[model samples]
Target chain A: MACFLVPAAEAVITTVASKVMQSKESAPETVHISLDGSTVTEAVKTPFSKKLKWLNNLLWGGSALLAFEHVWHGEVVPWFPFLSAASNPSDAAEMLHEMSTAGVTMAVLVTVVWCGMLAVSNVIENRAVKSAALLPSSK
Target chain B: MTLLTTVFAAIICTIIWYRNAPKSQMKIGILCWMYWGASLMWLVDAVFEYAEIHDEYFTPAPIDMLNDFYLGLSVVALGLIIWLVILLAKDPKGVVKSVLFKKKI
Candidate 1:
């Protein structure tokens, strides 16, 4: 239930990062035009960073939807003891601890795996690019 | 139960996605994050529940556990659906756009 905050936090971080990146002097090179003629800007991100960025966006968006669903179901209230399912302070605390532990573990694991994957892909891509440069294509 | 299940599913999906994701594609990562995020939310909920129920938490009624299991599955499915919608809307690889605008002789 409380895990929703993780995405909310991510959304805030991404927004700040985007703003900072956009304000930099090298911002012009980051801009690109898509097929639909929509302006897209490069965020000066590595593969891992890009993944994290989008991941945050996904989490934020999904959490918002879930929250809306919960509210509609009357499972959550606007006042204290927000969740109708959580009866007391002790229950809330216990739930929070459990969720925090799981969330932290999952986040850490996903991030590590992502980093490893990006590293491997970057190596392979670099090798291919280098080999292509060496073997001139026939015009 | 649903929280735990979604957490596991998210982690597994992340591992598989990372293994197969191309250098230019980050969509899978988004899916990973979404599920993980939901798992975390459930986790917090569990903690509070456990605290309130204390020993009783360990001896949850069978029906409640079963209900939780189903809820967890639904969450996983919903997460996937959300991710798919995002992937389609973003069209990061342009596959959808290409199909939509293909020439028809």
Candidate 2:
């Protein structure tokens, strides 16, 4: 379950790293693992790691939720009635009730961060860069 | 999770969208969608929580879809921000004063 966080973080990193790159063609909305990860790690560690730790957390956490859902809903679901959100009078519902709240909060933060980035980027839209590579490079 | 994290994410998403933004006035329109989407998840949910606490039911299920849509938009925006950040970093002196700080030096 925890491993889910790794991918979420990686996704953010991947997105950010890709942002730093200008592919010869159109800018891609989502990118996959096309190369080694060492560069991405260094990029995150560098000063300009893109925001959304909670988002990454929520993202991976959402994935983790899916995994848990699979486990309880698949093999041993009936035994663990508490894990089912749809099941009446169960702990799962209680947790999701609270979790939805958290998810909403996560959503808001994501929105804010998105706005701020746009503000900054708007200011620099016409600015120049030599080469927008995918890894960390001090400039 | 933390204030910085939240701010960073917002900024990054903004930058991402700016980088790939269409060269039309509609760019702002698109951004508004992203803005609304990103804010929807938390702000609306927060309102929902408050309403629930106050014994009020503020949000409808249809509204929830709007929230998720914005969230997804923000994710795309974040990716755009990253691309811009790299561009800015590569040409700080050129890109900085105008788009970045906007102060004469």
Candidate 3:
């Protein structure tokens, strides 16, 4: 029941943090000059990119926490028993099989969903660009 | 079982996210975070359960395992829903906004 609350809280925090931390400069650039006189410039990150990065960091942090917890529970043992938490060899095998199947399913499902969203986003962006191009320019 | 399932999901998501770290978008990262968080929560639950049940925690009944499996799937599904909601709200590409404004115009 309360599981939904975490993401809602995260969304609010991320949104506010993104706004608060938005850079004032139009395009903050980083310039690097090489020995051969070639310069490489890194483009400034948009506010949205910054938010994505923050969310990425949050995921990494959560992954670390979960890994630790798994280690604690012996479900992820390094040695002989493999899944130390399982009652027996057969149980461990079953659990392993179940986990693998679920993992693959979840990954494929998430990837498919992400691809759909990306396609939609691309379409929207293309339409916006086309519309802007069609507008008459003021001399 | 719920914890293990989510942990597996989180691990898979993390690997994919890491592979595309430079250009990562579409908010799969948020889904990863949600699963990991749920995994961590369930891990604590498992720990407390083990403390109470001792050795019996390992030899769970087949029916109990099946139920836990269902619960795990539900959590995963709920996590995806929450991520979708966030993605829609953020509308990073303004897709929703454009569609709404387009209808009005």
Candidate 4:
């Protein structure tokens, strides 16, 4: 019933982590010096913060949709304990059970998918770098 | 049924993302990923619910089906709203930025 809370909690953590990482992250620059003594600096890659943003976006979006679904079914409400199941001791226990089971499962599944996406993204970035390196230099 | 709805939305978004090609300033990729992830989550939920309910899972009441359809539509709308907010905030193509900063010459 309250499975969305798991991903929502994860999203909150990642969003904070992303902001912290972004603050600490500096674009790694490559310096190139020409024979004429002119030097140029350029950032060579996307930062980890940006990649974390992809995961944040996925988690937040999915959690939002699931939360809306729960709200529609009246499993979630606006006040007090918030979750309808929390109003009762037995239902609260069941809610916790669902959270540990389905909730955790969904969160892990999304994270695994995100990991796969990161792997593919890494491959794409590598390919782009390779192709760019293979190109004839303008110099 | 909700799972199917999300899967359909994901497929449609993916197609649109591909059609847009190199123009990623709008970040359709984010929306596609959202729907895909939601679809996957719901698929797992469906599997679990099926295991719990067995044959009843195949025979959800009409009212429940209708409610699910409504919920599915609302989720799609919410996703679009979230994407729109991101687009407006980022002003990917400078559409909002250009309008807001248009100088009086």
Report the number of the highest-DockQ candidate. 4
Q: Which tens-of-lDDT digit does each residue in A1-139 have in candidate 3? A: 1122233344456556656666432554432222222333223323444634445344334433434445544566678654464657686675655445433333333334445655675575455444444444311
Q: How accurate is candidate 3 locally (lDDT)?
A: 0.56
State the C-alpha lDDT per candidate: 0.61, 0.41, 0.56, 0.83
lDDT of each residue in B7-94, candidate 4, tens digit only? 9999999999999867678888878878987887797799899989999998999999988888888889888998899889988788
Clashes of each: 16, 23, 0, 0
lDDT of 1 by residue, A38-121 (tens): 233223324434445654555574466456546645656897778765777786786577447644544444345446756776
A best-first ranking of the candidates according to their lDDT comes to 4, 1, 3, 2
Off by over 4 Å in 2: A1-24, A27-89, A126-139, B1-105
What docking class should model 2 receive?
Answer: incorrect
**DockQ-best of 1 and 4:** 4
Each candidate's fnat? 0.15, 0.04, 0.09, 0.55
Model 3 Cα interface RMS deviation (Å): 8.9
Candidate 2: chain B TM-score against the reference chain B: 0.29
> What is the docking quality class of candidate 3?
incorrect
TM-score of chain B of each: 0.86, 0.29, 0.85, 0.93
Please give the ranking of all candidate structures by TM-score, highest first, separated by commas. 4, 1, 3, 2
Candidate 3 at residue B1, lDDT?
85
Per-residue CA lDDT of model 2 for A57-126, tens digit only, reads 3344333333332343342244645234445556555655655555445544554555586567534431
Off by over 4 Å in 3: A1-139, B103-105
